[model samples]
Target chain A: MSQIPFTDIVANLPASVPFVGPEQIERERGFTFRAKLGANESPFGPSPKARDAIQTAIEDSWEYPDATSVTLRQAIARHWDINTDNVLVGAGIDELLGNVVRMTVPPGGAVVTSNGAYPTFNYHVHGFGGTLHLVDYRDDHEDLDALAAKAQAVDARLVYLSNPDNPMGTRHTADAVADFRRRLPTDTLLVLDEAYSEFAPEGTNPPVDPSDTNLIRLRTFSKIYGLAALRVGYAIAHADAVTGLNKIRNHFGVNRVAQHAARAALEDQAYIDALKNEIERGKRAYAEIARRHGFTALPSFTNFVTIEVGGVARGDRLLKALQDRRVFIRKPGVPPLDRCIRVTVGPEDQRTIFEQAFAEAVQEVG
Target chain B: MSQIPFTDIVANLPASVPFVGPEQIERERGFTFRAKLGANESPFGPSPKARDAIQTAIEDSWEYPDATSVTLRQAIARHWDINTDNVLVGAGIDELLGNVVRMTVPPGGAVVTSNGAYPTFNYHVHGFGGTLHLVDYRDDHEDLDALAAKAQAVDARLVYLSNPDNPMGTRHTADAVADFRRRLPTDTLLVLDEAYSEFAPEGTNPPVDPSDTNLIRLRTFSKIYGLAALRVGYAIAHADAVTGLNKIRNHFGVNRVAQHAARAALEDQAYIDALKNEIERGKRAYAEIARRHGFTALPSFTNFVTIEVGGVARGDRLLKALQDRRVFIRKPGVPPLDRCIRVTVGPEDQRTIFEQAFAEAVQEVG
Candidate 1:
C-alpha cells in the first residue's frame, strides 16, 4: 500500500537536528568526555532553593501542569515591572520561537536574521515554511543595519537578533540595539533574544517595554539560573502579541516542576549575583590562558569565550584533536567565525582540564 | 505605531485554552479544592522509583536534555517490541498532536473526529487551519463507522480516535478499532490516542504495529504511569511517520527529569498493576455512589466515570453546586454528553470527601 502523504512543506523538509548533543557524541564515540564545554550550559548548577523546589514537586508529578502557567508568568512579569498579560512562558526559548514563527510568519513568508545566528530559529522558520534571508556579520558582530535593510527589501515578517550572541560572544550596546529596532519596518516583528542578557553588562539590554508591539524579548532560566535541563524560557511582549502566541502554543508544554523551580530561582537574586561573579572570574582565567598560548580571546560578556585559532581548517584539526583527548567543545560553521573554537566556562577543575587538553591539541594539530 | 500583524490563521483563531485547569478555577473562586479530580490526572501518584530518579536527576538540571530523547524512546520501543526508530518522544501527547496536525493538514485541509472527542486535538486542528468535521457519539461510544465514513467523505488528511474515549469514558474493542482503521482511506492518517490504555481492559486497544504507515498510536506516561506533571508522551508509528514528525517537532521540549522519570516508571510494571487494582476499587465505589444518588453511571474502562444526571441543565447545576462546595470536577459541554458529570477516581480519603460533596450537591441542585 502507498504511504500517507505529508503536508507539502513537511514532506520536503530534511530530517535534521539543529545541533548534535554531547550525549549523542558520547554514544557515537563509546566514551564520555573529560570536560563537557560544548553547549554553553552553566557549569554552576541551579540555585539551591530551585533544587529544593523541584525535589518537593516530584511528589505531585501525577497532576497536570497549569495550562496557563499563571504563577511563573506573574513572577516574570513582576521582574520586568509589567502585567501578567505581557509574559508568556514556554518549555524553552526554542518552543517559543516555533510558536512565534507560526503566529507571525505565514507559509512562504519572509524572515531575516544574521547569517550564523541561532540554527534552531532557522529550523523553526523552515519547519513553518518561512523563507529566510541571511545578512552576513560585519566586523565579528551581527550587521544590524544590514538585517534591517534586508527585512525591508524582503518585506520580512520577522527578524531575529541575539544580544551577547552565541557562537561568538560579541554584543551590541543597548542604544545600538534599540536604534536597530527603530530602523526596522513596523510590520516586521523583531525577536530580541537575550538568553545571555544576565551575563552581559547591566546596561547592555534595553529596558523592557511591552508597549512596543513590534518587538518581543526572549529570556531563559537555561543560562544564568542554570536550569537548562528544566527547559523553562519565556517571552515578554505586547499583550496582543502574547495573546497571538497563546492561540497556537501547546497549552501544557511547560513541565510542572519547571514552573515551580523557575519561580524559586527568580526569587533568589543573591544566587544569580554570585553566579555572575563566578562567571566573570572564569572569563578572566580563560583570557589569561589564551594570552599564555599566544591566541586572541574575543571580548566576552557571556559565560563562554571564543578563542581564535589560526584558520578554519586548523580550527577543525584542533577541534578533532581536543575530541580525541576527551574534551568537548564546539565551533562556528560559518566562514570568518569558523576560525575560532567556542568553549564554555566550566568550574575550576574542568577549566584546568580544558586548558591542558587545549594546549596538547594545539601542539598536535600544528 | 501600528501593531505587527498576526498570520491570518492565528489572527482568526481564538485565544482559548482547551480545558480550564482546576488551579485556574480555584484562583478564580478564591478557595482550595476539597477533591481535586477534574482533569483525570492520576490520583494514585507515580511509582516511588520514578520519584527517586527525578530526585537524582535534579543535580544535572543545568545541562540541556538529550535532543533525541534516546533513552526514553529506547525504553518505549523495548516495551512495544519495536525498533527505536519507530518511537518518537514528545513533551506530552498534546504536543505530538500539534506536530501531527502540522505535518498532515495543509491550510484548509479536512479533518474528522467525534464532536467532543478531545478539545486539545481540535485546538491543534484549528491552530493549523484544518477544517474539522464532527461526528456525534453513538450510545456514548465514539461512532467508529461514522468517523470512518466522515473521513472518506471529507477526504480528511487526519482522523482522531481516543480509545476509552474522554468525557464519556466509553471504549470499543480492539478488533472493532482495527477494522475501522482498515476502512479509512490510505491517505487519511489515523491518530489513535491510547492515553488511557493502561487503565483499560486487556485487548481493548489494538497491538502496536509500526509497519502500518497510516496509523500513529499515541501513549502517555501521564495516565497509568502517573507522571502527567512531568509531561512525557510517545508515538509508536512507522519509521517514515516518525521522520515526518521529527522534521517539525521541538527537539528539546521534553524535560530532562521527565525523561528519566518516565523511563523508571516504564520499568516498574508491578507498581502499575497494583495501581490498576486500586483504580478498579475506586471505580466500584463511584458506581455505588451514583446508584445511591439515583443516577446512572456509564460503564467506564478508564480511571474516570461519567455519571448521568437528569438533563443538561441539571448537570450544569450539579457541577456548579459541587464547585460551590469546593469539590472540583468537570462535565462534557456538548448536548448528549453534557447531561453527564465526569469524575476521576481518587484515593480513599479524597473519594470519601467527593462522595459526601456529591450527595450534598445533588440535594442542593435538586
Candidate 2:
C-alpha cells in the first residue's frame, strides 16, 4: 500500500505528543497508581451544586449544547463585571490556546514563550508551522522583561505567560504582570494565562479593565472550582478579540452539563473558599514533608508544590521510585528546574500517601 | 492602542462561521421556538444508563480527564472488534475533522468535498488556509465518482464524504462506498463521516476493516446514542492514521463525564434500538405531513427528512412563516437543493407543534 501524502511540514515533523496521562502509564505497566498528583488536578472535586446540576442535565446529552454558551458566559461576565461579549468559552484553556495560536500565527510567524513554560502552547505553535522563540526563566519564574524584549526584537505575533506558573510553581505579582503587559509592543498579542489565579494571594490578579485590548486573560474551572473533568475555560478580553475567536472556535465546544455545572460552580463561593483552605493545608503538609527529606520546597500560590532535589538525576530517580511505589509525581524537563519534582496539593489521605512514598523514594534514590 | 499584527493569511481570511444554532435564532426573535428541529439533534435524549453515569461522574469533574481516554477507547475497540490502537476518540466529529485536516492539508493544500455537505468541515479547511475543490451533489446525493475524480485531478490531500448524508438526508449503499474507496487515489485520505450511521439502513455502512489505511470512518454518539450535548465521537482507521492524530489532537479534549457517559451509552444497545424506532416513526409522520402539503419528502436513512418546497423563493417564504409561528427548521444553501426544507425528528408534542406551524406556514406562503 502506498503511503498517504501529507504536507511537507507535517511529513517533516516528528509524532511528538505533549504529555502522557497516568492512565497510559498504568496501561503500560499493568498497574494503577495509588495516588495521582502528576497532572496538577484539584483533588477536592467540584461543588455539590455543580455536581447536582450535571446529574440533572445528564439526560439532555442528546441535544447539542447552546452554541452561544449564553448562561455560562453571562455568569462569567457577571462575576468579572464585564460584558458577555468579552467572554469566550471553550472546551478548555488548551483548546482555546490552540485557537488563539491559529488566529495570530501563520506558517513561519514568530511566537515567543519561556523556554520551559507550558509545552501545550508550543505544541500548538508548531502544529501551525509557527516559528517558536524561547526565553529562559529568571529565578524560577517567567522573565517577563526578556519575553517582551524578545517579542519586540522578533516582531513576534504572540507571547504566552502563565502567572503562578506550572512546573516550578512560581508567580509574579499583579503589578509586575500589568507592567509587562503595558511594556509589550502593541503589535504583539499577550496571552496572560491566569489558570491558577483563583489560588493566588491578594493583589495577585490585576484589576479587570475591559478597555485593554492588547492582552487576553484566560481562566479555568479546572483549578479551585474543581471542574477539570468538565473541560470548560474562558478567555476575557476586548470584545473584538473574543469575537475573533468565534471565527475558528467550535461554537458548541462547551458541553451542556459543563455549562450548567460551571454556572453552579460560579455561584458556590463557599465551596471555592473551602477548597482554598484544603489546598493551603496540603501545601503546608507538602512543605513539611520536603523539609524532612532535606529538600527545599518553592513557595507556591498555585495548588502544587515544587521541591528542589539537589540534582536532575536525583529528581528523575525520585520520580521513578515514587511511581514504582504507586505514587505519581512529575518533574520539569529543563534545568535548573529539572532538579525539582512537582507535586499537586490534595486531601490529607493523598498527602499521607505522598509523605510515605516520598520518604521511601528519597531513601531509594540516596 | 495599535492592533496586534495577525498573519497575512489570517488577515486575508473572512471571519465566516459555521451553522448558527436554534437558540440564537430564538434569542434574536425574542421567543422560544415551539418545535426545535433546525440542528438535527435527537429529541429522544440519551439512555438512562448513560445519563446516570454522567450524574455519578459529576463529582469527579474537579479532576482533569485522563488524557489517554483509556476506558472509552477500550470500549470502542471492543465494540468494533478492533485494537485500541486503531481507535481515536475526540471532542466530536467536528474536532476530529479539524485535526485530520490539520494533519493532511497544510496551508494552501487542496481539499475536496461536496459543496453543501458539512459546513463545519469546510470551515476547518478554510481555517487552515487550504484550497477547497467543491463538487456539487448529483441526484441529491454526494457524487463519489466526481469526488474521486476531483481528488485525483487536484492531487487533493483529503476528500470528505458524509454517508447517510446531511442536508439532503440521502445515502449511498455500503457496496458503492466501498467501491468508491477502492477507486480513490492511494495518496488521497478519504474521511467517511458516518455520524448518522446507527440510523442508516442495514447495508448503509461499509464493513469495519482496520486494515484499510486510506479511509477514516467517523462515528458519533450525537445521533443514535443521543449524546450531542456531551460532544463525544471516535474515528476508526489503521494504526498509522490513528497515531497521526495524536500529534496534534487536544489530548484532554473529551470531558471525564463525557467519557463515562459515552461508554455507558455504548453498552446500552436497547436504548439505541428504541431511538432507531422513534426515528423511523418520526420519518413516517414527517412524510405524511409533506404529502398533505403537496410536497415530496426525500428518502432518508437518517433521523431527519427533507421536503421539496417547489422553489427557493417559496421555501424562504415558508421558512420565515414557520419562524414567525415559532417553528424552527432549516433549508440547504445551494440551488435545486435550496428548494427544500429540512426537519429533524422529535417527540410527539414537538411533532404536533411542527405540524401546526407547517400548516400555517404553507397557508401563509400560498
Candidate 3:
C-alpha cells in the first residue's frame, strides 16, 4: 500500500480508550463537573510538601528530567527497603503496564486477568497482540485462583491482579495474595498492581521477595500520595524484568516536576495517613448515601465506593442523571458490574452534593 | 522458563540511552556543570504566563489530566489552522517518534535517517526491531535527496528529516523542504522533525498538508516554547496516524501541568519573540568566543551553535577540557562532525561563564 501501514497487529486493533477522563465528559455535556468524584484520584490533593516542591520546580522547568530517574528511584527503593536494581519508574502504572505487555507478551500469546479488572492492562495486552483469557471477579475481588489456573491452562505469559481493586474497591489479604503468588504457575509472571496499597489496611502489600521470579508488583504515587496528575508510578520486579524494561521503555518519560514531587510525597507518611482517614470517612458517607437511595454500597478498602442501583437500566439512568446534574462519575463497563456506579472519594462537601444529586437523579430516572 | 522472558527482540536489545542526559555526566564527574549549556534547553525559561499556569495547575495534581487532551489539542489545531483530528500530542517528540516508528515499521522492516541525526529516532527504530539505513548528512544539512533515495532502496516504512537541524545547527529553506517532500517516495512516511523550526529563519516551515499521507511533522514545546521539563510535544499528521496513536499511547501521559504550560506558552507570542532575539544574541556571542579561541563557529538557525575545533583530537580535548572546568558541552559522535563541539545558548551571564571557562580549558588542553 502507498499509505503508511501500521503493523498488522496494530492495524487490526480498534481505536480504544484505557479509561474515559471526566474532562472529556464535561466538555461533551457543555458544563464543568461540579463534584468531581471519578477516576479514584485523591481529593485531599498531594502532600503540601509535594505541592511546594512542584511550585519550586517551576523555575527550573526548562531542564529535562533525569532520564535514569536515579534519585527518585533511590527514594522509592528505600521506601520499600529494596535495592535500586529492582526498581523501574515510568510515567505511571499505565505506561509501565504497556511496557510489561510489550516485554513479556509475544504475538498470539495468552494472558489472564479478571473480566472486570483494570481495563488498562487488557488494553495494553490487546495493543501488544496478546489474546486475553478473562476470569470473572468472585465476590467483587479478582478470582486469584481462577486467574492462576487459566494462566496455567493457556500458558499465559503474564497474569494481572490489582490489590484493593478498582471499580469494586474491594481487596484481598496480603497473606492470601502471597499464597496465591506461590501457587501460580512458575513460568507465568504475576503482575501485582498495588496502586491502592497505601490506602488498604496494613499488610496489604506482601513482603518483597526480589528473588520471586514469578512476581512483579506495581505501585503508584497516584492514590494516597495524591499525585495522579504528576503521573509517577513504578514497579518492583525481579532484576531481569527491570533490565528488560530498561531495554524498551522511554528513558526520559518521567517529567522533572514529577520526580521531585514524588520524592517529597514519599517522604510525607503523615500525609498518607491523614488522607487514608479522610478516604475512609468518604467511603462511609457514600455507603450512607446508597442506603438513603435504597441501594447497596459494596464494602470498599480503597478510596471509592461501588453502589448497585439494582440493574443495568437503573444504573445507566442514574449515571446519566448524575451527568445531567454536573456530577461527573464513572460506571463499571461489564454487566453485573455495570449494574453499579463507581464514585471516587471526594471532599465531605462533595459528598453532600452527590448525596442530594443522587436523590434527585434516582427520582428523575425512576 | 521459570522466569518471565522478554520477547526476543527486547531480549536481544541492549540497555541503552538515545542520548546521555547531562545530569548523568554530572553525577559521574561528581560536580555540577556551571554553565549548563547542553541539552538545547531554553535558558530564558518558560514564559511568565506558562510558569504561572504551572504554579496554578500544581494544586490540581490529584486529578488526572485529560486523556483525550481536547482543549490543548483544539488550541494547537487552531494555532496551525488544522482540525483536532489532524493533531496528536505526546510526552515529547521523543515519544511521538516512538509511536510513529511502532505504527509504520514492522519488525525487520527498513527505516532511513541521517547517520548522525537524532539518535533518539534510531533508538526507537532499533527498539521496535526495525533495521536502520543511514545516509550521512551532506554539507551539514540532512541530505533530502539521499534520504529519499535510501527510503526507496530499502522500501523504507519511514524516513526522518530534521529541518533546522540539531547538533550542526544548520537548516534548509522551507521551499527546498517542500520540494523534497514532493520527491520522496509516496509509500514512505517522512518524519519531518521541525523541533528547531521556530528559531529558524522566516519561511522555515512550509505549509503542511493534512492530505499529505507521506508526511508526519513533529513540533515540540521543548525548544522555543521553553517547556522542555514539562514534556509536551505534538505531531501534525493525517488523521489516520493520529488515530493509530490513540490506540497505543499512554492516555493520561501528558501531565495536567504540562498541558496548561504548553497552551500558555503557545499563546504568548511576545515571549517567544523576545526569547528568539535573546537566543540570536547568545549565538553571536558564541561565535565571537569561538573566534577568540581560533575556532570556526558554524552558521546556526537553532538555539545552539556548532564550533569546529579544527580536528577530532582538538574537539575531543576541548570537550573533556570544558567538562573538567565545570562547563558542560557536547560534540557530535561521528567523525568529521566529531571535529566540532555543540554549545547551547544560555543566559548572558552563563555565556560569559562559558566563554571564560572555554578560554581557560582551551589553553589548558593545548
- Compute each candidate's TM-score over C-alphas: 0.99, 0.97, 0.98
lDDT-wise, the better of 1 and 3 is 1
Best by TM-score: 1
lDDT of 1 by residue, A247-295 (tens): 9999999999999999999999999999888989999999998888888
**Tens-place lDDT digits, model 1, residues B1-366:** 667769989989987878889989899999999889888989889999999999999989999999999999889888888899999999999999999999999989999999878999999999999999999999999999899999999988899999979989999999999999989988889999999888899889988889999999999998888999999999999999999999999998898999999999999999999999999999999999999999999999999989998899999999899999999999998978899999999999999989999999888888
In terms of DockQ, which candidate is stronger, 1 or 3? 1
| Candidate 3 CAPRI classification by DockQ | medium
- Candidate 2 local lDDT, A1-366, one digit each (tens): 667656666666679888878877888898988998988888778888988888778667788899889988999999989999999999889999998998888788999999988989999998878999999999999998899899889988899999889878888989999998888888788998999988889888889887787788899888888889999999998887876788778776889888999999999999899888889889999999999988999999899999999999999999999999999888999978898999999888989999999998889889
Tens digits of lDDT, candidate 3, A1-366: 457667898899998787877887877778898898878888779889999999899988988899989999999889889899999999999999999999888889889899888999998999888999999888777888888788779987888999988878888898999988877777888899999888788878788888777688999988888899989999999888898888888888899999999999999998888878888888888899899878999998888899988998889899899989999888998966888999988888888889989999989987
Error of 1 at A200 (Å): 0.8
Show pairs that collide, candidate 3.
Answer: none
| Tens digit per residue, CA lDDT, model 2, B53-83 | 8867866777788887889999999999999
Better of 2 and 3 by TM-score: 3
For model 3, how does the per-residue alpha-carbon lDDT over B207-278 read when each residue is reduced to its tens digit?
Answer: 878877778999999988888888999999999888888888888899989999999999999999999999
lDDT of 1: 0.92
| Candidate of highest DockQ | 1
Q: For model 3, what is the error of residue A2's alpha carbon versus the real structure, in angstroms, after optimal superposition?
A: 3.8
Best candidate according to lDDT: 1
